[model samples]
Target: MSELLLNHLAGRPQAGSGPGTALSDPVLGTELARVDATGLDLREGFAFVREQAGAALRAMTYAQRAALLASIVKVLQANRDRYFEISTANSGTVKNDTAIDVDGGIYTLGFYAKLGAGLGERRHLLDGEAVALARDGSFQSQHLLVPTRGVALFINAFNFPAWGLWEKAGPALLSGVPVIVKPATATAWLTQRMVMDVIDAGILPAGALSVVCGSSAGLLDALQPFDVVSFTGSADTAAILRSHPAIVRGATRINIEADSVNSALLLPGEAPGSDAFELLVKEAAREMTQKAGQKCTAIRRIFVPEALYGAAAEAISARLAKTTVGNPRNEGVRMGSLVSRAQLAAVREGLAMLQRHAQVLHEGAAHALVDADPAVACCVGPTLLGARDPDSTRAVHDVEVFGPVATLLPYRDAAHALALVRRGQGSLVCSVYGSDPAALGAAARELADSHGRVHVVAPEVAASHTGHGNVMPQSLHGGPGRAGGGEELGGARALNFYHRRAAVQAGAGVQSTLA
Candidate 1:
């Protein structure tokens, strides 16, 4: 055992068994920490958050909560270097990937802080404008939005422990809801440390924010009617969470971001070596390799013109070939290992299933680890598989291998490509690359119903376009159908999740007073 990372209950550390679940570095296989919530009354935690922290936060205005968020940003910034060091040891990530989780979190918190400042001193939100309930001047109606009286429980994925916690917390805190985060066990170290830093700062009220680091056995059962649960993980797990008795009984609000086979489509007008073609290739390769393709929005299916399929495959493979995978601290290493050995095994198994229907264009398994032992290191290079007859392969469309892996599919034309992309059921994002504005607009409109966001990339914006898989704080980050019919991160719209709406019908004078 290295260190016992206790669960933070009501801003106090709750110690568990001396030896708990061991967390190790994926690359070096050295124990980093342990987490256990052996004997804590979770139901009391829910009550503490609602009665204590929730009351304290609700007493403050939006601007006051925003100021608190700003103070947290400063605290996180002061300890950023230490966070980076821990990310390398626990997350097996280099500087760039760690920045996405750490700095990205701080950035989101700061953005929400500035946005909340504009909301002023209002403790509750008004929805739209007041309307007449009757023809007479004496009657009126106004829709009101008030913060829920319970907590927000976040069940996050292992890939983004930091960004996952803050992005959701920023809006919930602003909405006057306390938060309890149960980070995925694999990468709980960084999440635990970040919470430790915040608690040490003493800026937040006790129970305003808490982290449960061990098993999530009884957390869901403690939910009250006003409580909300936001989860990020595989579709299977999302389905399981949905069927939990509390959620099934409508005693809690649930939001999910599940498996998505997101795509990148190169429009038919673009030919080989053109700007659109090159941009698609670059983005596809980057999405496949960044964070070791563990991102929920990573481009898993690449759609290009049938005539230019070979060119796209060769170009993307060239990029993946240059990426070196090993221990994140090593020089010249462009990518790091999977979060754990279990994840590595899962990716390999999924790849084998997809290979039954597709050819391996780039065999990442053949690549050797640069600075870590092959047997101990949980490493895998970027892989590009090609499904020549994509229309016939079910696994290529349905299975999401959460690693540095992607499958290239050839489309006959724009319509053909759209049909193939829809086979993904639904996704978080899909980028259509082309040079024509009219064509790109048409494609984007067609994809709007299936994808939360349709990123249209052209020659003009290629230089400035954010990469395909990068989830920005200012845009919608969830999708419909298999991707989970939940929404998040669309500016102030995200605050709606923490609010309860009601139509207040009253006399004109009363309505005016309430407003």
Candidate 2:
């Protein structure tokens, strides 16, 4: 049996298992108890989530709830080191990179806490004024944002177990709804630790947050119309879940944030020998290596002016060659391992497909690392490929090497570049590199219909740009079409996903009759 699977089976606690032993994984460096079968049963889990939503709403006033949220932030800060350790062990992220995930996640919680406070204070506005005496001498009209009685089931991807969960939970919790999180097994340990912290803080109601490890099993089968489901993972799985009979027959509300072949474009004015050329290389390299290229938002396609195709290839290759790959714990280790060996294999498969339509400019598949275990962990060197033809299936689209991999496609013109990017159908993000405002605006508008978010990066804006791989709390995280037809963050936009909006009204004489 695989080490991961063996560890999973061994970690299952007996009914009488002692406290620490019941939930501890010596290999993974974390203690997380598996949910009792009774607690994890779909029906019971649903009931628990629903009841917690009510209790969470009743336990505190708006101010008190906001205060509880603030307390969560403090707790997360104090436990930051512990969480980072868990992240590194389970997800292969270095402490520095993992720290960003923890910090950003904490910020998300804090943002929603403030949002909850704001909503509570402003809810009175939603309570529309009761107009005095209608013609029949009766009060009339009212409006409010009430919580949905159903639960929220969040099925998350392996890349971001912590951030993804809180991103969904923060909004739902603030909106007075309960959430059930199912983290990917490979990195479930990190999520378990964070959730335990929340539970121990005594901020959330008992049932406000519950977690399920291992397979989803019967979770989706019993969903109701009032329940809300959100997912972040591959497109194929999203399709399967979306087409489930229960989801389709009962019309359950579902949101998906899947993977996509995202791209970036360099304008004609930026030849390879120019400053713009160097900037493009740096940007693409960063996208390929940061988070070990695990981000769903990373730029998978690089479109360069055909005249400077060779220059662009060399520039990117040179940058990638210099990147150091090893254990994230080691100093100066710029790139780390993929989340797991399975993920490394998946990325290799993606590169194999790209070989048909592109030429590899740089290969880091074989390298001697100073200190890291390849068997227990896996790391792919950064790879850069040049598309044989912009219009080819493997050139601008139809492939995504999830690890530190990128393809450079040469476009005949701006129009052709836009066409190549659009072939991917829809994506989470597309970035354009150029100093000309007209060029940036033109490319952005042309590709606007094809991408959910477009970021313009030029020498002028480069200083302030957050780069291509990071997604902020206030921004929408999902893309269109193949990327998943759903979004995760967007402040109140995410909160509304857990709620059902119904326009309630009564007959004009109803109010008079009641009085």
Candidate 3:
């Protein structure tokens, strides 16, 4: 075991294994750390957050809360080197991919800090103008927003340990609610380390931020009526969480961002070697290789026009062939292993399901090793498959191979492309590529009906546009239907989740006094 788990209620870095689990490195297949939160009192932890941390945070101005976030940013920046190394060792990601988790977390906090400062010191947020209840306006009602008197329970996915935690906690703290984070068991080391750092530095009040790295044993049982739970994972897990007694009874609020079969569409006019076509091919390969394609939002389906199907397949295969997979620490390695052996098994199972309808275009095979054993590491080369009959292929549309894998499908026209896009049921994001802005925008608009976000990658804007897989802090990150139909990280709009909006009915004198 590396060290004791961090339990905020037990005064940070609580010792003793006490029936726990070991976290192993995906690249080296060695024990990296241990997680055990058995001794923690869930009831007492919840109580401390509600009575102490919540009270202290509720009393502070938005500016003060933002200052706390800024302090957190400083600390994370100082320790970024250690975080990068941990990410490589534990998560099996290259420096570029690790930056998406570690530096992305820091950037999100910085964004929230500035946004919180702009919100000013008001404890209550006004919603529009006061409503008139009488002809003379003596009686009126004002809709105001106040912080929830409960904690935020975050059950994060394995792919993004650092980004997932801060993205949720930043808004909760700004909205005056405490946080209890439960990261996925496989790669919780990075999250545990960050939480320990925060607690040790006294960045926030005790109970304001806590973490449970192992099983979420008694955490959900301690939720109250006013609490909120944010989860990111598979659809099956989301269903289980949605059916919890507290959630079903409306005692707690649950927001889920589940797995999605996100798609990338190539317009008809773009030829094989054109800039738009090249961008589409490059982006599809990038999404597949980045983070070993473990991202929930990674493109699982690529839709190309029927004319460019053969060329598109060839181009994508070439890109995957050039990608280097092995230990992330090596300078030449472009991609790394999956998070663990279990994840590798899961990806292989998913690929088996996908192979029923699609033929392998590029079978991901490791060509070189960077001072690591191939059998021990959970590495998989980038794989691409071609699905000629996408209109009737059920597995290509539904089954998601969560490793560096993608399926290529062909569409006859714009209508056919849109049809295939909708076949995904719902997705977090989809992209359209072409030379004509007018055509691309119109098709993207049609595709947007089934996607949370649609990026129109015209040749003009392809250079500056963020890739299809990148999630920005300023936009909505969740989608409807199979994508979990929840919204998150829309800048200050995210703070709404932790606040309760109520309409106050009273006379003018009462309204004035309340203000």
Candidate 4:
């Protein structure tokens, strides 16, 4: 591998004043690059974004900003191949997995671009229909949504440097807010490359987009009152960010996507050999193996009918057995390594803790990884676990082992399943598979309060439904409670996060213009 030295984007590519840290290939354990942020002037960078980039972006109308997003889409598409290569090398993901990050990011940007165009030439947005204050309708009150005159600081996770950065950036840029991304140090290479490419294309104004790819020492300290911070990582880190003075004292806006023990439910009355049963098995296994099960939305606990507990466990384990783990470069490798040895160790540690309360249905430890050295390669196959009595198991409900690991639990009925599902405290998503529409709808409604999204899959919509863990641009993401009481990505609604709302009481003539 070539030795790469990544530079931060502060209006342009620049080196740090502190010593840099080396990055290594997760699968091969070889040094790949270095990112230095020891003495980065993040406060100065924020000033540049708020003044230079902010002014230029705000000068453009919604439609003009949409055009810029469209240009970014084209640039990403043109360089998609290079991005896939970087993701595979640095993140240790297969082609299909890499597409979820690279292609997903492009698609999200495109979605926002088209969405922005629909808003026309407006610099601000109207929340709803204007309300009449006077009985004669002469005075009116209208809610106006205007972009905050501040910057957006994105602290992305290791599992999705590509999509994580773009997903947040899409809405922020569309809302006329500038962004500075701080990718997870483990997988900063891909994020840096993409940011570099976009800036090089000159599609965005200087200071409109920036990236700091090393120690996030001064990043939080640089926040202003109007600035927004969106973070995706552990709940512990989210708590730390929430307690920071910028958010607590200054009342700065913040959104967090943290640890979630999401679930997949097989509603009662579905026979072991039935279509719904099979579909649930397929989806549960897929969620466990996709991205090596590093996704926050991935299924950690699976609930099924008490009668089919043993059968369900057997079927899911059989499917997981077919997943071949190895390097992404290999032709038939269905599953790839974790992002790094540190991640692998963390997953193993968490898994071990959960094992005390559950029995292993299928251990991936014995599964030999193909075309890679077991000593150096950070590879692990899919493992299916079973909790004979889920109500008695605390770790199965509270702990999240972020790897290709999942535990099957049994429930007596729909009510029982819902109770068990809620044991997660809160989650990003919960998928229910069944043939009964009314029952499925009821389940979804009940799950909605605790989950950010509830995917209901009947046989008719099975093939068309996006996977349980996939976060779509048109739907809501993030959840309440342990999943983080945050919200994002529901079409134009996402733009609200980057904007401030105010109710304007004005005359009929002034309100008519807003209407």
Candidate 5:
């Protein structure tokens, strides 16, 4: 990694006056960069965006704004190799996994650019037909979604440094709002680097994009009435953000995508040796191993029929044993290390709590790592545990280990499986696997009540269905209760966050000339 400065978009590189924080490569324990953003004042930063960047973005037609994003996509794609290399080193993800962060960001920008062109050249969006406010039709009202003059603040998670920024920035820019991104301190190197590249491209207007690398000391305090803040992290942090004075007083809009205990259920009646069984086991193991199970959408609970409990455990364990954990650059390393040693320790604590209600089915020995030293590198093997009494085990459904760890529980019948699924309270996603459409459909319908997405993998779609851990751009990436009850990346619906909706009531002739 190269030495880079945090881009404040304040005309020049931000002066490093604050305490310098070091960003490290988890796999090699090497320093990547020193980040500090102390000299910039949040109040002035936001004021500059409102008067400068926000003005430029809002003045442009929707088509012109969309074209800017399209140009950004070109710039990022032109330098994808560098971005992929950085992601692998900083995030400790394998080659295939790094693509999700680097390539996924480019794809999201492309999708939003095309979407903006389709939105036309209108300045304000009209919601449905104008309604007659008076009986004589002298007065009418039309709902409008207008761009907010305030800035959009993004507090991202550590797991996805690239995708997290682009996904939020795409909609905010299209909606005519400036953005100030504050990535998680532990993994802010990639995000800061990307922000610098965007600034250098000069595709978007000046002051349109900025990033704070180390501390967000006064950012939230500088928020105005029209501003919006989006956060992705733990549920505990979400609760604190929700209760902030700005959010509580309706001065700013807040959106959160918190961590949850997501589950994957194998419906009853599928034979132990059938394709459905194999597919279910493969999906569970893949989700557990992907990104070292650091994803928010990773499966934490696996529910299987009572008859197939032993078989499911054996199959998943066998697949997990084939995984090789080490440095991400090594070809033999199927899975890489955790983001840092601190994260690995947190996972260990969570696993200890979960073991009180379950027994280890597949324990990864510290000495079994390939091409790596477990003491120096932050690596955790694909560990599996089995909960014998599903109904009595509260921690199995409530606790989230947040690493390459998953607990398998046995369900007696259809009702038992549904109960286990609902015990997660609310989840981002849940998958159902079986040959019977009738049973899968029933289970999906019930699971949808608690989960934001219910993925049904039947025999016909088993070969083509996306796995349980993948979050698509077109689908809503959030859920009901514990998952934060927030929605993001659901196509054009995300634009609503960067806009302000209002009902414009006026006479027919006046309404036509309002804009």
Candidate 6:
């Protein structure tokens, strides 16, 4: 990276500062540039999106779409290193973490590409016999997964900006739907870079993929009935969007995946000094520190057996103490800064609220790594707390310090642990660590009603475990209540979000008679 690029990555003043104002990189800076809401040209963009969707649907066979997506995979592979560099620079994600996002995102595109190709070999609903009607005869019906004559609007979150945007866009495009992408300003530059790459590849039609770099003012209001809106962000924001008049009144298709207070449970069989005990500690710490703990799937709560609370707390704290927090570009830095100063502040506020019912088990605030410069970056070390009362509102459940932070909550028994996990209302994911299959299954079933995804970790699966902080393309990625009562990504389920279904009924005997 050049010096100018480095400065841009650091979000430093590019030019001389004006009186009482700074010139931080508008691209990677925490604060977003204010867009002129009224001046946005949605009409042209909307028309172009519609045109491209139609053209892409008409011109390309499903095999052609698959070939285009395969080309995208090759393009991404060639630029993988560049994406890692840019993603780390823009979002403070470490190289390995960013690599996972790139790899996972590429795999998602590959999956959809295969799906598109499969659509070609399958028989279209219209392929069946078409009946001719007699004097008083009526025709029967058929079902087809045709593309809806509308657009897909994607509103992505700051964390995993590239992945969020591409995951939705890939599937929608494969299903022959044009997508209008609106990435959160915190990391829009990375998304923009990726989109530019896609456009250069010439895979998508002219208006099949359009981007809104800034605000999306009046965008939702202009949507039609068959239009689809998929959002990935906070539950609070999802609620507001869910209530939009265009969506509610027009019954517009909407899919949401919001941040949730996910948890990890350590069963009694995993006592200290045992392999299972050690595995639990490692899993929790990894979830709390990876991607600087910005992921919605990160383990925010740790549920431990009452008898082993002290030992579990000590093990977790010791591991967290070893985490190296600094600039991601620095060698030996295991954990990087939070995405932005504002996000760091939000984490701090959540910590303050959590302190009301929890005691600090480990304090990384006082410790500093040699390469870290807090004054010049948004950095916070990993922190662990032991909740005084697991059932308390201020304890393990309500608060979500969305950084390298986790709260250890003690449970008297398996039943109590399951009850405490439910106090969070709904979570995107939850994990249980133990070698006992029966015990793990019971707890999993107990919490299955409240969590969207659950993982059982043991000696057998620990090595290959993706941990609690990862969401895959094939899985449903949202939960109920506090986690946003909507889902995204379940094969055809995501594609269906962009369509409307209506039943046409007639006499079947009349159709046969006419034939």
List TM-score per model, in order.
Answer: 0.99, 0.87, 0.97, 0.98, 0.96, 0.87
Candidate 1 ranges with C-alpha deviation above 4 Å: none
Summed backbone clashes in each candidate are 0, 0, 0, 0, 0, 0
Q: Taking the tens digit of each residue's C-alpha lDDT, what string does model 2 give over 339-377?
A: 766787798887888777677788876555536655545
For residues 99-176, could you state the per-residue lDDT of candidate 1 as single tens digits? 988999999999999999999998988999889878875787799999999999999999998999999999999999
Compute the lDDT for candidate 3. Answer: 0.88
Winner on lDDT (3 vs 5): 3
Instruction: Tell me each candidate's RMSD, in Å, in order.
Output: 1.0, 5.0, 1.5, 1.2, 1.7, 5.7
In model 2, the clashing pairs are: none
lDDT of 4: 0.91
Q: Considering only N, C-alpha and C atoms within 3 Å, which residue pairs clash in candidate 1?
A: none
RMSD of 1: 1.0
Off by over 4 Å in 5: 1-4, 513-515
- Itemize residue pairs with steric clashes in candidate 5: none
Runs in model 4 with CA error above 4 Å? 1-4
Give the Cα RMSD of candidate 6: 5.7
**Ten contiguous residues with the weakest lDDT in model 2:** 2-11
What does candidate 3's lDDT look like per residue over 1-515, in tens digits?
Answer: 46656555523445434857888889889987888887677787788878888999999988889999999999999999999998998899999999999999999999999999988877868877898999999999999899999889999999999999999999999888988899998989999889888888888987788888787877878888899999999999999988888898866988889979999999888877999899999999999999999998899999998889999999999988889889888899998889999999999898888887789999876456666788899998888999899978888888888888899999998888889888889999998888887898789778777888887788888779988988888987898889998888989889999999999999999898656
Look at candidate 6 and tell me the lDDT of residue 233: 85
Write candidate 5's Cα lDDT for 176-229 as tens digits.
999999998888878887887888987878889898888767778888889999
Cα displacement (angstroms), candidate 1, residue 363, comes to 1.2
Better of 2 and 3 by TM-score: 3
Better of 5 and 6 by TM-score: 5
What Cα-based lDDT does every candidate model obtain?
Answer: 0.91, 0.72, 0.88, 0.91, 0.86, 0.73
